[model samples]
Structures are given as C-alpha cells and as structure tokens.
Target: MYQLAPNIDLLFTEAGDAPDRVRAAAAAGFNAVEMWGPTGKDIPALKEALEETGVQLTAQLAEPRMQFMIPPKDHAPFYTGLDAGVEVAQQLGCSRIVVGSGTGFGGRKRQDQLDELIEIFTRGVAHIEGSGITLVLEPVNIRVDHPGALLDRTSEAVYVAKGVNSPNFGILYDLYHSTVEGEDVAAELANAGDLVKYVQVADAPGRGEPGSGSIDWPARFADLRNSGYTGPIGLEYYPTIDSAKSVRRIQELVAGR
Candidate 1:
C-alpha cells in the first residue's frame, strides 16, 4: 500500500494549529504529514509533537513563496529562505522542500524566464549542498487555481529540472494541477520518471477530497504505480466534510493498492 501524507495546512484543520494538526494526523493513523511553509510556524512545539507522535513530515514549501513575483526579483531572499527552510527541514527530519515559479519577469521571453529558474535554483541548491535534502519545483495550473503562475506544465518543470541538472533537484508532479491543466497523466509521468521526486493530489473541478470530484482516482493510482513513483502522495485538498470522513475514500484506495 502507498503511504499517504495529509497536508496539515488543509486537512485536519479542525484539530487547531499546525502542531495540533500533526497530532490529529497521527491519531488518524497517518504517520506522515506535509505543510506549506515553516517560516512562521512554532518550530519547537511542532518538533515536540512530531517526536511525541512519531510522525514524519513529508515535505514543506520554501519560504517567501512566489518570490519572483515581487519587485527587484534579486531573489536573494529565496536563497536565504532556502537555507532557513533546510535548517527547519533538518530539525524536523523532513527531506523535501517544494518550490514554485512565480509570475514571469516583465516582457522577458518565456523560455528565458524558465532558464533563469534553472540558474537561480542551481545556486539555491548550492546553499543546501550535502544537507541530504531535495528541492522539488512544483508546476501549478493557471486555468483554475493560479491564473498567472509561470510554470503550469509538467514538461516545463521537467525542462527546468534538467537544466538545473542536480541529483538534489527535481519536479513535484501534482495530480490535481496537471488534470486542471489538461495534461495526460501517464504521459507526464512517463516523461518525468525519476525527476518526479514528490507528488500532490486534489480532485479537479473543485480541488476537494479525492472522491468529491470527477477524477478517476483508481485509474490515476494505477498509472502512478506503473510510473514507478514510490513516494508519499501529499493529500493537498480541501475537505468537503469532516476530515476523517473526507479521507475515507483515499484510505480505501490505498488499502486496495
């Protein structure tokens, strides 16, 4: 069975703050959880809860999300944030950090902007070199969720990852975003292969729990296994009902797998 990691930022929210959500995930029989960012989180308390519950954090986002969208775009904060994120990940025993390409730089060629990411993240990786952590660039869909996101296609993310050319750098294949963007799941997975370091899921049309939408979860899961992606799938979706009830469908699917 595939080990599923609930997004503490979205799921188990009724359990209170982020630290409390970690405990809630553990109680729900999930040994792994993921969150957005570690910047403003109560690190000491979060670490304590993880230790107490023995839950492993699957991943967290790099701080100053969408840094490029802001002015100057010197991107220095992104590097500093990467360092801070690595330290937080190390403290919590997490191994992956998710990143995104913000809006394109003014009037620049699309390919140029993408290439710029390759350079920026290459240097960012240098900051965390030998830390045994990975930086996974995420491609978000613009059709529904992010209207101006720079990297919207899996192939684009693959291109950036290849250009970066680091063992510690890869792409995050988000099933929901890909579906919303109308990419073929099997095709993208086949193309990405090992560079697909992390995966996230939410059903399209609503970005809700897996069973709450029209996505063929079982078929998607089959294709995922066929692609040989043996990583924790992050449940990054909004719950339409109680958190536990929202996860029932995923629980059944994971068990059947």
Candidate 2:
C-alpha cells in the first residue's frame, strides 16, 4: 500500500503560503506534506501552521552547500548546516532528511570521493543521534537531474550508509533518479534493502507523474512493497498538470494497483 505525500515546492507558483499549502494538501486528501526550503522561511511559524493543521511533514531536502561525496575537505560549515537542519527536522516531527552528495568533478579519484562522503555522513549522523531523525543520503541522477552529482549510484549510496554504520543514517531510494542513473531498480532494491529507509518516485522523460513516463512504476512499486518498503512513497516530482489533480491521478493509479 503506497501512501501519497505531496512535495509543496512542486506547486511552487500557485501555492502562496507554505501553511496554506499544508492545508491545501490536507484538503486534497494528503495526510503528509514535504517541503524543500523550510529553512529559508520562518521556521517557527511554519511549525505552528503544521501543528494547527495536523499535517505531518515526512521528509525535507537537506541544504546542498558542500560536496558531500566529492572530495576537497573543509566541511566544517557543511556539518554546521546539517546540525541546523536536524534541529528543524526534530521540531517538525520529520523522521528523514534528504541530503545531496555534492558534485562529481573531472579527475577526482572515485575512491577518495566515496571516502569523503562516508566521513562527512559519519560526523553528521553522530550529531543527530538519538534526535529520532535519520539522515538520508540521496543519489541524484547525474545524467539528467543533476548532471554532475557525486553520488550517482545506489550501490555507492548503500556503501556510504553502511560505512557510517549508524541507525541514524540511511538512503532514500528515488526511482526516477535511479532510472536516469542507469540502475536496475529491482537489483538495487535487493542489494540495498536493509539500508533504504524511504522511497520516492517520478519518471524519466518528463520528471512528472509516474504513469506519464516510460518507467514501469506499478511493477517497481510491487517490487518495492515485496522488498519490505512500507514507508511513504514520496511524490517528489513537478506536476505536468494541476499539482492537486496530478496527485489524485497518481492516487487512483496506486489504488488500482
């Protein structure tokens, strides 16, 4: 059973107030909402609105400033950003935070970059330990969405999660990006089942709703369910049509499945 959670930022233009978006999501039959730039807004008031509306905030995009997986050291400020992000996540009752693994540059040894990611996550996760929020390292699609994202492979992300070896850290398996990154979704799921804490989806060609693109979402969704992914299937995509309508369409598709 897939639970739908809308990314408010996708409805960027039409949506005026963040609090109103929460209420709108609830009205549109969404119990949970995810926001990307909560830190840029008034966090205290945002928390109050979420509380009053009784809308659950599931996950958020971590501030992408440092090259987490890409090398070159000097990540003191990056770690500080994670610290601030974790505090906000705790306050919003959000369990997972999605972090981008910097950019991959030409000539940087792959092994050295991977080591840097592991080191950075290890330190960041330690600070957020027992805070009840887990840090999720997101492997973006270098081919399309990110072009040069450092952590492009699910296997690499899984390796980094394991290297951290803390319950406070995990990987968010976003299928759209995985497909773009050339990963066989089923195989990645099988290999990284234990380390994957959340799953998100869109599609390749359009990066819109699931069924609109070439991805076999139902088949993948079934595989994910069978693989024990009982967490929220985040609708982290830009809507080709009305955001609310697109959500309903996806909900119907999931229901039919």
Work out the TM-score per prediction: 0.97, 0.93
RMSD each, Å: 1.3, 1.8
lDDT measured at residue 91 in model 1 versus the true structure, 0 to 100: 97
Write candidate 1's Cα lDDT for 148-232 as tens digits. 8889999999999999999999999999999999999999999999999999999888999988899998999999999999999
Off by over 4 Å in 1: 69-71
Model 2 weakest lDDT span, ten residues long:
64-73
Residue 34 lDDT (model 1): 92
Task: Tell me how candidate 2 scores on lDDT.
Answer: 0.80
> lDDT for every model?
0.91, 0.80
> Any runs in candidate 2 off by more than 4 Å, and if so which?
69-72
lDDT of 1 at 55: 94
Score residue 249 of candidate 1 by CA lDDT.
86
Candidate 1 residue pairs that clash? none
Please name the candidate that would achieve the greatest TM-score relative to the true structure.
Answer: 1
Enumerate residue pairs that collide in model 2. Answer: none
